[model samples]
Target: MVGLLVLAAFLTLADRWAVLYAEHRAADALKDRLKLTAAPEVEIDGFPFLPQFVDGRLGSVKVTVPDVSADRITLASVSATARDITLDGDGPTSVHGARVPELNGDVLLSFADLNRELGASQVTFTGEGRDRVLARGTLPVAGHDLRLRADVRIGRAGDQGIATTIGGMRLDVGDLATYRPGARASEGLHLTPKSVTRLARETRKVRALLGVPSVVRRMGVPDATVREALRNDDKLAALTGSRDFVHQAMRVNLLDLTLAHPEVLDRLGLDPALLDALSRLTRPVLADQLSLGFRLPEPERGELWLRDVRVEKGGIRVRLAGQGLAFGD
Candidate 1:
């Protein structure tokens, strides 16, 4: 009996030591993968007396990297920390007090002092048969400050896409104007290129449905061709006095009227033929460019500002310094 008791004790010690060693190795591997300068400090306080398993407590770890640079901006520090770790079973783990710092100017446009006031970032993950992640953070840009909070669930079926929704967002346009003067700070900004293109299409649709004569003229379709078509086509001529006829004429001119003689259309609108040529027009440009400028208030500040941004033909350009500035968006 005495020998059996001694053997059990040795096995318990061995299991405890192995668990601690595994934890240390995992932490060290994470540090190397992240290219951090310092290894995380880990501690395990309590051991399961019955099962000989180690329970981690009062654990704190930090990793830091210095001198990160990208796109002409240099960042002085990137640091992350994990605290108060608790592991239950071999498959499930819980951690609290996780913090990660933003990458300052290296990844952002302009450096702002307000970033320090935003506080530390955090993320949490819980896994059962699948994994779920929740994250919250803040970031600063040249013209605005962003706050984000989101939750993501993984391992879902079908092409339904990950479910995401903005919890809260606040933009400080007033602060942005300080960097670029005479910019319209109050103009609500849309960051997504797809939405902007959709808006342009919707606008054209509404104009056509309303029979807006000026808009039809601007679309480079000769009003003369439309007027002549209405005169010759008996079915169309009968409906000329009706509002629906006006809408139909505009729609047809926009969609099908390709004028062979552009001069006829130009003379009708009192404009030159070159202006009515739609050969290279009407193509929506997609903009994938990053903009770094301040939103300015009225009564110009003698500083250059971005105005009237337009995306067309898979290209994005902004009006700045009294001229259109082209940039890859």
Candidate 2:
């Protein structure tokens, strides 16, 4: 009986040791895959018996990352959990209640801020199924305050291959310096449709003069509308109106505008004699239509804020002084 008891005790010790070994290995592998410089420490306790290598349960694994940096930005207190882990070769790993405490940098700018400042922001990435990324915070520009939030998605489909979508995004500009000093910074102004229409008309005329049929075609209007707009000055004028109607129309047909037209190119201001030579060189490029929206508080010079101001491939919308919002025709 004494010998048997001793053997049982030895076996129990061996089982606990094995579980600890496996848990450590898995944690190490994960840290490497994430390119984490600060390796995670794991501890395991409580095993009734020597677990089978195939279905062992990890009592607990805690991962702590102190500081992770990319360029100028540094993320502190980043952690996650794998609450319950099973050593099954076929089942997918599940993670729950994951979060990062804070991300700070000299300047952490998002897509919206970059777009507003520079007119465009281009991002390219590769990943697997329905991945979502989010960022929120404030960015200061030349004494003006700006708040930004953005959500983006990357999706994959069997037939479509890889696709990306900008789920939702918003940029709030507060305390913008109005044209007039002593003016309330929050009083926001709305961009007029007339401005949008005028720009659209100018674009079409330039496209026609350049003799670029493909350029006009890409604007997505029915060939009939393009033909009619080209032939009748009044129709084109009416369609452009004083709003963003033209901007929206062209956004839908961006892909088709690549074909070139000499007449349209000439109208863009190149000499007629040079039209033929430049025809091959003329390329279709996207244009950004300017839209402005403003809002004013009770006291006109108290505070000016710009809200619901957005520019997209299709159109622009803005609200001024809590009212008089406008969209291009």
Candidate 3:
């Protein structure tokens, strides 16, 4: 009897050990799929993992990823769960339709970084950049060149990208005209590409103050082409009220449109053809790109699908779900 009891206890312990081991394997595989440098926090629910292993199915899976970055922007946290997962010979078989409960993405573009993009390296950041970042230097705001102290507020520009609105109302050096970003700091000031011509209708001004006309002239397409592109967009059709002649309203340029209301993109279809055209006109090598989103890499052949996008403090948390996500072979 003693021998039998001892054997049973050993089996129980081994079962628990194997469960954790399997959990780690799944987590590691997930990490690779997400392009994470470290193993994500993974948990598998169900007791006596051995039985589930033999059956080739798990009850549930939860994973926590700390950081994920495509380029300049970084997603701070990502937590997700999936039900009825299949364990495959190589690893966890592609989980179909995972649920993402919570995810956080933020980018800290220091004052220095912002300046580099603006090509105004003369400006420098002061103190910390958490709540507010102060840009101290001279910038050509509005019409006049002024030595100014600008308060930069960072927030979600739209469904994607970050927006820095400079307007805490402080001109330490010049007259009332000294701090001249525009006549009205109160107006909504957004940054987006010129090609995204729809954005100018809403914002105080597009960031095309410099050579926008030249760029627009370079890619002058007939109004007919723009109209054709809009017609192809079915999503934009469903969400908005009435679709009118929106081509003449659009000037030819190599910039993404940062609409006053970014929520519109959510309604746009997922075809990416129209957006690709708008986002592609941009010549990153020629000039500073005023993009409006995290600009994540294009998905590779059904790897994952972005479901929802929410703007939060620090960065935008985009929800993504995958059906059978596979890793490097």
Candidate 4:
């Protein structure tokens, strides 16, 4: 009984030793074959590995590599699990080739790394939902940094790449006082349809604009109506709350107003010199500055592809899969 127990202990230790040796050798092989800067962490699962070693088949193996530089972004982590690995040679050190019948993994693009790599425009990425990311940051506009926000949808780019589409973009006119000096733009100038609805609810700002004789004159509000609004609070509220007022305000595209009515800018205390700078900012130029498209590197053998993508709180995760993956041939 004692002899059997001792033999069992010896076998256990031997098995552990062999597994470690195999894992180290496999890691080195991967590092060299993949041209990796550092050796990847390798784990051979489903052990009592000696018998599997003899049969030249590993049931499962997991590999994790960090900080892999890609086309436009650096992948924070690249991990994969290979199944039914068939070795081409008798031993781990002697193996010159191998076959992976199935492989699955994910590449993580951490927001921290992405913010660092794509920091040229000072844009930052955050998860908006399961399949979408929110990109919010400052963009250069009219010789000043302006706030911009966009919802980016992530999807498979062809077979092996991950693609991003900017669904909608809006620029917010932060600190209206900056443009108007001592006063604020009562029109609440922002570049989107949604802002038009918001401007209607801001009765105080509308009142301020109506208070200015120049603004009321440029907007074609009657002098009698202004006098009635001043005496009757309800009338003042009704005038600003009117659908016609909202519609007209919504139609006041700053670009068109800048060209057609210099009086409007006068009420807002803006210099006409800034009109040229605003004119240069177009939808295409903003879209190009916020461009976020990239492709994955091709594999040397068999097939590799992106299966799915999800936006996580910290970053984006891309599911990857491959079949009949060959190494060291």
Model number with the top lDDT: 4
Per-residue lDDT of 48-70 in model 2, one digit per residue for the tens?
Answer: 52443434444434455444443
**How do all models score by TM-score?**
0.22, 0.27, 0.42, 0.70
* Candidate achieving higher TM-score, 3 or 4: 4
Task: Show where candidate 1 strays beyond 4 Å.
Answer: 36-329
- Candidate 2, poorest ten consecutive residues by summed lDDT: 285-294
- Can you tell me which runs of candidate 4 are displaced by over 4 Å? 1-3, 90-92, 119-122, 140-143, 175-285, 288-292
| lDDT string, candidate 4, 6-83, tens digits | 999999999999999888998998888778899999999986998988888899999999988787678899999999
CA lDDT, every prediction? 0.32, 0.36, 0.44, 0.72
Residue-pair clashes per candidate = 9, 57, 8, 0
RMSD in Å for candidate 4, one decimal?
7.2
Clashes (candidate 4): 0
Q: Candidate 4: TM-score?
A: 0.70
Best by TM-score: 4
Model 2 segments beyond 4 Å from truth? Answer: 1-150, 153-196, 200-255, 259-329
Ranking by lDDT: 4, 3, 2, 1
Which residues of candidate 3, in runs, are more than 4 Å off?
1-8, 29-35, 90-292, 295-303, 312-315, 327-329
lDDT tens readout by residue for model 1, 1-329:
99999998997788677657755865575557545565544443444422423343324433344533322223334333333433334432423222221111111111221122212222112222223323334334422244433333332122211122222122222221111111133212211333223323343333332244543464344676455534454533333434444333332232122244333233222123222232222211000011111232221212233323332221212232211211111
Worst 10 residues of 3 by lDDT: 172-181
